[model samples]
Target: MNHKVCVQLVVAAWITGVPAQIGVTYQIFCQNFCGSNKLNHIFCDSSTLLEIACGDTYQKEISLLVNTFFFVVIPFLLILISYFRIIATILKLPSTSGKSKAFFTCSSHLMVVCLFYGSVTIVYVRSKSSHSAKSNKVFALLYTIVSPVLNPMIYIA
Candidate 1:
């Protein structure tokens, strides 16, 4: 379980961070081409560094796509499968002996799963035409940072 959790954390971080890095780079390029050399916002600034890193959008796009596939889709599918299995197991159990206890136990797990995956799905599984960057960043932070902090606390409770 610890190993699995570690792997999941690593994978999740990669998934969240890669696109964020790409997005930052893109924002940087967009800034450099469109705005001044220096960025006004602390977190939003990457123009100076990105300009030094890559010359074209094609290379950045390729990197973004590859990272999205490996980090985003792959782990999401795995997590979805795992959660389905958990739900299936919970459903399969007879609701007779200690059913209430079982439900309580599984409910916490399910809540954590929902919180983590739901936030991620909301952020990533939307049309770019539909959601704004602010909304995406909000949900992204929830799933990536807040969910991890809450997971163990939920388990303990």
Candidate 2:
């Protein structure tokens, strides 16, 4: 029970923190990007924000690298390490009567973790190799907007 509560709190912190970071970054970027021109998408797009923030050549490259690292790479590594530790602990457990039940619970959690992390990694990990503005926008939409919506669906399932 204590472990569950702690885990829930940690997850809550992460969920809250990521978006807050994004929001702060967005505001900082938007101050530069949000004038005169109307954004095509309803939600404030990160790429659009970046395009606006990157008015100068130096600023553009720096903003791109920073956004990619923070929004994509860091989260991917964190999720990977988390899941690895989870699975390792599960695997090392001794067999018992409740083992099946424990496995079932872990399976559901593993599924959600994989789905969320996989989508995020698929999108953001690609950014490290290829530097396409369009791809970044598409992945940003996936990781930021679409994945959050799907996360709840995974939990519900």
Candidate 3:
């Protein structure tokens, strides 16, 4: 079970990170040259590095697409499948105590999953929705700092 979970997480991180990294790298590089737009890191915009990555509308669209797929759809599908198998396994157990214990473990996992994904989704969505640099910084900071801090606490709880 531990191995499977580790594989799932590693795969999830790979899937989520790689494509977006390639796409963003290509977009930032190509667009700046291919369009001959001045690549100025001006103070008029970008309070955080995330804002710089998402400086343009096209970049923002790409980010939204990646986040929607990786953070929302893929995780939802994986979690659903895992939970289904867990339910089946627990049902096959002979004793009430075993099933209860399984469910308790699953519930904690579910809570942590919710906390991690929920904050990320909110950060991505909020970043996309708002035009303010300050709010974007706040969202970025929350995701970068608070989510990591909370994840372990959630697991411990």
Could you give me the TM-score of model 1 versus the true structure? Answer: 0.53
Candidate 3 residue spans exceeding 4 A from truth: 1-16, 26-56, 126-157
Q: Tens-digit lDDT track for model 2 on 10-125?
A: 99879966886775566565555445576544456444554455355345445555665775577768876877787677677788645675666667666655655665555434
- For candidate 3, write residues 4-98 as lDDT tens digits: 99999899889868986776555545432233333233232222233444335565456655756765768767897888898998999999998
How does model 1 fare in lDDT?
0.61
lDDT of 1 at 73: 72
> How many collisions between residues are there in candidate 3?
0
Candidate 1, residues 22-133, lDDT tens digits: the string is 7756655563253344433223323223333434644544554565565567776787688778767767877656566767777776676777767765654454468765
lDDT of each: 0.61, 0.60, 0.61
Flag the better candidate by lDDT, 2 or 3. Answer: 3
Better candidate by lDDT, 1 or 2: 1
User: How does candidate 2 fare on TM-score?
Assistant: 0.52
Clashing pairs in 2: none
